[model samples]
Target: MKDQTIEDWSREDLKNQWLCWIDTIDPKVSLKEGDSVVFPKKRIVVQAEMTPLVKSIFARWERLSPSERFSAWEQLKEATKEAMKDVLPSCIQCGECCRKGSPVLRVEDLELLRTEKIPWSALYTIRSGEPVTSHDKGEVFFLVDERIKFREKEGSRECLFLDSTSSLCTIYEDRPLECRAQACWDQSGYLELENQPYLTRRDLFSHIEVLWDIIEAHRSRCGFERLYGLVKKLKESTAQREAEEIASKIIDLTSYESHFRSFMAEQLNIPFDILDLVFGRPLERLLELFGYRIRIEKDTKFIEIITQEGPFHEEA
Candidate 1:
């Protein structure tokens, strides 16, 4: 019956349920190894009962309205203020924290980027499935799920703002909200920040949401998603001719990327760099994820592709 109940609980159902309370048995209360007490009208289950519950809640959070999410974000900021009251150790300039990874950008941090205080090239987004350190959840209960985070450079996990010689953040005065809130030595501080709401892509960049939507539409309408889906299918299929045909189609579609670029520029007035920042770069990353390599040569309008351990080149 417990298994059935678990199976029947949907992601939405889990979001609505909370751990109301748990029993606290006195230290002097006698009990046997195999014995259990029956509450007259209630039932009890193991602590592990909450695992799937939390997972479900986390997964479906994207379905929440923007207003709902922002409200939660505000609450978290208030909690962080309270958490900061705890005694935190002074920084000794060890550089360990700065070395670990870049401080992720919060909603308030976007202003720095908008003002060009931080260059876009120095920033990258860890998309929904990429591995990331969940500072909001802490290391002890580390979340191994895809939550969008604004990371620094690809090669070095260190923050771009770190000054190597001084072992201090170069942009200390303009550091992100997470950076200001962090307390490396305080366990309770970590716990307090756990499960706090994060800004969604839409929340941070609503001005570009229309562009994102258009790119998404193009991805669906064009064979972009289908091309990758075919690649996965080709990997599992036994037929060689079918595989070649799919690979050929994939190469053919690569040429259309320019058309997409032109269409966006002429119709939407978005420049090449901004388009690349918002969509093209991430699209390339997505293709790379599907075990395909794309090299675009703008000088000659050339594209190079490798699939099935072989090279394919297309020219515009």
Candidate 2:
């Protein structure tokens, strides 16, 4: 009778008969050791593969006194109620998605920029081949194409347009195309994002002759491809003099890039902070993407490349 009473609980049983608080756990897998879950009368240990749970040993459970069964039913009722409370019908206006990552702009948002509803300072460019973190993959990879994205608030990754106190979007009426399409409760819209064309830096500024000329010149001198090649040269140089020469070239490029951004901003009345839209990230951060770290001393700057052996310093 003891052996015959135990049986594997079906997922349907969890939903209907068992009322097993199936909301939090994956019902597809059977419960066993190492899995801890609140059952009707107990906290059961479960491991799906090895020791499948004897979750429906009805005869053994019936051995409990009437008071114990009453207490167990109360526990199950409360757990189910707690789990059901978090299902939201609509957005809570918490700005969690905006805080985690600002929406990537698309061609549709161009009108917003023209109207100055989304100010220029609130945007930044991710240049072609720049290293960017992928939230889906949890790894860094080079961006295949250039993109214009919203800038984040200072000292945090929250969207620049977010009003922190009330968790409201500052430009909700003229929010970016991606912002308008997103519905966290629904997943259907996000797949469409993958197929949409992103807005580009050239799309925004290439029409202006003077600004475009300077931007083109900067990309030629300080682009990720050129910088990464320099890093490779620095690492492979066998002689100290050759390594020093490579470092010097990198230093010259960095100096020239800095002067370029400052001068262009002043000439065009662009905010200094928004220069990333004009010229990708600063050379220092670009170098970091190439496996190099930089530090400054009294008069000298040091660039260190990390390798399999370890990092070795180079004076620039």
Candidate 3:
């Protein structure tokens, strides 16, 4: 095949060239290129550094748009992960990973939830399409599918399961698949595991017809995707008149969510948190995740978007 100039090549073509290039690098096993992580296979500790060829390809990546960069990164991760069927590394009881982020639940972990005494307060849902930190990258991106994650301790990112003093998992015997699969030394297993089917609200609650329908309706109405777009508009709208209109829509949506959460908590006699296992974290909390700070006035009916820098004002 004749080589097309890089600018003329499609992302897929670039990705293919990448696969072919990496395939020729060395016969030894390694996870993927980019991140400086080593994979121990056959006693071959392949030092993962950017070779000249790898650097050339990454230089091409520098020219890509943000969306294109993410797409290419995903494609590369998927393609390169299949080669890394690594030996699982044993844990040394360091809680650093747990302190960094909570494990995302996988389908294999569902049985634990069904049989165990883990409370709803301990877990929260990440709605499909919600922006969340990627388990592998730590970069915030919209999820392609919904996930349930164990909540962190109050005011800390440490996993609720991690015992800080002992550096042990409180639920060591019955940890989620993500936790079981994770190895800071060799993320190949974790990376491969990430592509597998994961638990969703539907998987847990779909059996109850009335409950499922209500959850679906609530997700459709109060989803973070809509709020994210509105907040983005709130940030970018240059016109005061248009900004006011956008802020009003934001407040109206917040009101609907507040009332629904209150009504559901009251009617079901379940803590408002139980609903978070289905619909996702409350809107106020999610707004902060999306990079907006929320404050309620005396009325307590609407959220005021506040930040150290510029924030949207309802009056203006």
Candidate 4:
């Protein structure tokens, strides 16, 4: 085949060529301060100083307009055809995560699974608005409110679509978004492990932090409105008066219990756990610090805040 000139190549052609060039360079080449290489086959040029050349290309690419970026990418590709194949590393499929019950399905995933006729059991109960639990040990699925029971004995622990014998997904073409979005070991060295193909808690926590930011933004927009509606329903019910009275008594007991524990702790200088044995939660400590005084009247729960000026009442 006749070699194509870089000047006559398309943007995609140039990119492919550049990637090919980068892939072909010997790791032992030891790129130095001043050196250059020319690929006559691809009709492209590359410099010896790896750091400066890469930095310049990336910086210039960042400053380009979207259309110009495409042009520059093509130019880079034409300049480095040997690097194209090195874009992503290979994956050795072990399917450990698939077998170990790590498949996380969002609500949208249900539609896909239903369409595919995948045999997966729903983990939640709609009644009581709480997660169902195992008959043996009452542990709820924290996020899903579903019990953690598997579909069949074999399919229960493994991903519904995973084929154990082949170590491949049966529904590879129609897998859920989570499966498609996951790029394990892309940045971290976790994928390098022979036994472990999963991310650790630290990596998962970092992902959760990013998700929390998104949740916080959404909450700022509409969380209060939803809470207000719930509160309003609680306030209007016939059981509202009884509930408020119970809530008031509980609050006062909680407040006094908190203060009493703190007083004991300060006087004895013991660890908070000892106090926790007597009284649960930081709310007790908080009540002591704030000097909580609560009073219930008719259907209203009142909180009296003691200030230096005087005491003031607030109704819930």
How does each model score on lDDT? 0.47, 0.64, 0.66, 0.39
| Residue 240's lDDT in candidate 4 | 58
At residue 168, candidate 2 shows an lDDT of 83
lDDT of 4 by residue, 275-302 (tens): 3222222332223223344555896546
| Residue ranges of candidate 1 with Cα displaced over 4 Å | 1-88, 110-122, 129-151, 164-166, 183-191, 204-231, 249-277, 295-316
Clashing pairs in 2: 32-46, 32-47, 33-46, 33-47
lDDT, candidate 3, 1-316, per-residue tens: 3766555566556656655655654444444475445333211212111234334445667577767765755555443444343423465556766887787777787778778756667888877767666666556666777778888788788898899887788888888878887776667778787467877887888998877887878888898778888988888889989987887888788778978877876765657666778678777666765456555678654545445352211000
Worst 10 residues of 2 by lDDT: 41-50
Quote the lDDT for 304 in model 4: 52
User: Which has the better TM-score: candidate 1, or candidate 2?
Assistant: 2
lDDT of 3: 0.66
**RMSD of every prediction:** 20.4, 12.0, 15.3, 21.9
Displacement of the residue 226 alpha carbon in candidate 1, Å: 5.6
Better of 1 and 4 by lDDT: 1
Off by over 4 Å in 2: 1-86, 135-139, 232-243, 290-293, 304-316
Local lDDT at 116 for model 3: 71
Encode model 1's per-residue lDDT on 148-213: one tens digit a residue: 333444566566677767667877777666666654443354355445554444554457777768
Cα deviation of 137, candidate 2, in Å: 4.6
Candidate whose TM-score is highest: 3
